[model samples]
Target: MPRSQAATIRESLSAQIDSGLLPLGSKLPSERELSELFSTTRITIKDALLALEAEGRIYREDRRGWFVSPPRLIYNPQYRSHFHDMVTRQQRQVETRVLSASTVLATPALSQELSLGPLAQLLQIRRTRSIDGRVVMYVEHHLKPEFFPGILQQDLSQSLTLIYQQRYDIRYGRSRFDIFPSAARGEVAQALTLAEGSPILLVFRINYDQHGRIIDCDHEYWRHDAIRITVDSHVAAGE
Candidate 1:
């Protein structure tokens, strides 16, 4: 199938960025100039810009025109069932900075969420997630070390789901997610390279096991402009 004119324009611009022809934060040509250069209508150029914006590659300024945006944070909670999996699935370049990992006594809130015993020790892992070399989100996860023996030795930059599936034969059952607008805290701000109290999206997720045991709990804070979440629902035939 033939690609649309807008798609072609988007591809051309994307190639420039990828090849370092269009450096980060550089302003793109004006809509009229792009239209003339591509031999397309200005409307087509606008559509291309919108597509790039959706992908987090560019943004519009009031009077300064369009400019390359910082890298976008990709979150695909739908498949492979882990942050690293979702990121790699999009073929996006990324880096994970492990902020802290240690065995700690579960707090009251953590114990209740994970259904842990009062004195249970949880393996807490915290990381800063980056996309295309830009910090984008802060993540904190808790797991039962007893269930994931030798987990500390594994490379976490890869999918956690892969590790459990390959090493322990553990598969994710169902998950519950809650999202809300929030203000970034001190450490979260530093990790995400944003100012303290910056607007962000806070996500809380609970992953359960086949036997209904809660296996993991995660808290993620994402930059407001770098992430998006989509949900879809369908009615049953009987309904």
Candidate 2:
């Protein structure tokens, strides 16, 4: 038997995207236009588009039509590189928007994580980072206020590492990172424009000084398909 109309349309569109005829990041035609072009019903067109989206060949944005999925950015966990530098090095544009910044009382969890006293004041910073006009990461950073006095007055959108070195003469000595696959829920899901329970990468990080003092802590949530992490291994001659 011949394939269904929806399947045929899906395969045709998939071929166009694969051949670069559609081009990555290019918006697909409207559903109405597609239905007419294929001489099919709207139901068939909708099924075709949904199938493409589920296969990761395309994505939908609010108020925008479907677009071809872009390639993921390559990331190396061992590199202590800033987000701006790493993205631009790959020839991609990156934008950091400081969502909010304020001083808040440290809750028990925040206090223990940052090695601060209970009820101590901490600087809370939230930011959203996007690449090529696609939002890929949401971050929350907490810092002990005493370490960098008047830090709230500085532009928090700049590199935090630079601020630590220039303003406080502090340097990153060692760090701890915890990364895991998790489901995006609540605000994290909304920020990434995904439905609740979408798969995402959750990261917890702590930066420390030479004396083992905690400099800052961070919570980052990333789009699952937007990052490709790499790790390298080398053997010692003596071993």
Candidate 3:
């Protein structure tokens, strides 16, 4: 399939960032300005920005406008299974500001996604993910607390995947993912330093284990300009 217009805009902006045409902390052109430059509508520009935000490439500041974000460590979902694992493997300085972490009754959506029965308790972890001191992504994860005893006691700044590996010996297996462009929610805007309705990428991931048991469900909001996901497929020799 051909890439969408938003995807094209995303690539153009990303190229600028990669080539240092737009340096970290440099303010991006205003929506009106970008629309004029791209010869498209402001709405298109908005969509493009949201895509960049979800990739953790650019951040918006209240009244100050959008600025280029620091580079994010590339994370290959096909190979890496954990956020902290991928970041640490890249040797990038990473930190998580725990926005909220507590046990909560699972909502219907959470229950359905985690494949839990009604009334199941869920451990909710909300974090603002930062790299090199810049906020780039906001994540909310739902996990069954019963499966991960004493999880709340561990240092959340470390890799949650590693924690599982050491504590429970559970490893991530195959997963399904869906990605799309979205506008920032109110809290997401605040966390990513973006305006309400700023552009971002929404990633919904469902992870499983060796036995095909659901492990966790993750909702990741990335700065649109900061990352790109590449998928390659080929048929087997026999096929």
Candidate 4:
């Protein structure tokens, strides 16, 4: 059977993308332009583009046209590297946007995790992280306000490791990380451009000061397809 107009458009675009004619991170032509080029209706052009998006070959940004999907980032858990440094090392551009910053009373669970006294206040920073212009992770960080005075007043989009060293002469020390597979839901899913209940990676980390004091706790929700985690293992005596 002959292919429909939309299917033909889809196949042509897919072929271009597969053949590297449409490079990664490159934006597709506007809907009107595509419609004219394909000599098809706007609805047909949209259907073709949507089919490409559904295949993970392209993605859309708010107010921005669809772009070719970039490759996934590689994360090495055993390395103690800053987010910006690690991402740059992988040759991918990474950007962080602070979604919300506020001071709130610590919940019982949070209080215990941070070992805070009664009625402790925590500075909460929520952020959306994008790799190669595609939002891939949503993070929430809870910090004890007493350690870093006026932290909320400073720019939170920059690397926190640099901020700690420059402002307070403090550096990150030993840390604990708990990573697991979980469903992305609610705001996290929305931030990563995925549907609710989509499979995602959940990471919980507690950062400590050089003196072994708990500095902050972070919860990160990641699009599973956007990252591959690897950890190096050492050989044991008996192995």
Question: How does model 4 fare in lDDT?
Answer: 0.84
State each model's CA lDDT, in order: 0.78, 0.83, 0.80, 0.84
If ranked by TM-score, best first, what sequence of candidates would result?
Answer: 2, 3, 4, 1
lDDT of 2 by residue, 1-239 (tens): 99988999999999998899999989999999999999989999999987887666777655567788888888765556576888999999998888889998878987887777656988999988899999988998998877889887889888887888889998877678899988778878777787667567888888887677887888999876688887564522222
Best by TM-score: 2
Instruction: Please rank every candidate by lDDT, starting with the best.
Output: 4, 2, 3, 1
lDDT of 4 at 183: 81
Instruction: Kindly give the stretch of ten consecutive residues in candidate 1 with the minimal lDDT sum.
Output: 230-239
Per-residue alpha-carbon lDDT of candidate 4 for residues 1-239, written as tens digits (9 for 90 to 100): 99988889999999998899999778898999999998889999988987776566776654567777777788875456589999999998999999999999999988998899999999999999988877889999998888889989999999887888899988887778899988867888778777666567898988899899999999989866577787656622222
Candidate 2 stretches greater than 4 Å from native: 1-13, 30-56, 235-239
RMSD of 1: 9.3
- Candidate 1 lDDT at 139 equals 91
After TM-score superposition, the amount by which residue 96's alpha carbon in candidate 1 deviates from its true location, in angstroms, is 1.9
What's the TM-score of each model vs. the native? 0.67, 0.78, 0.73, 0.71
RMSD of each: 9.3, 3.8, 6.1, 5.4
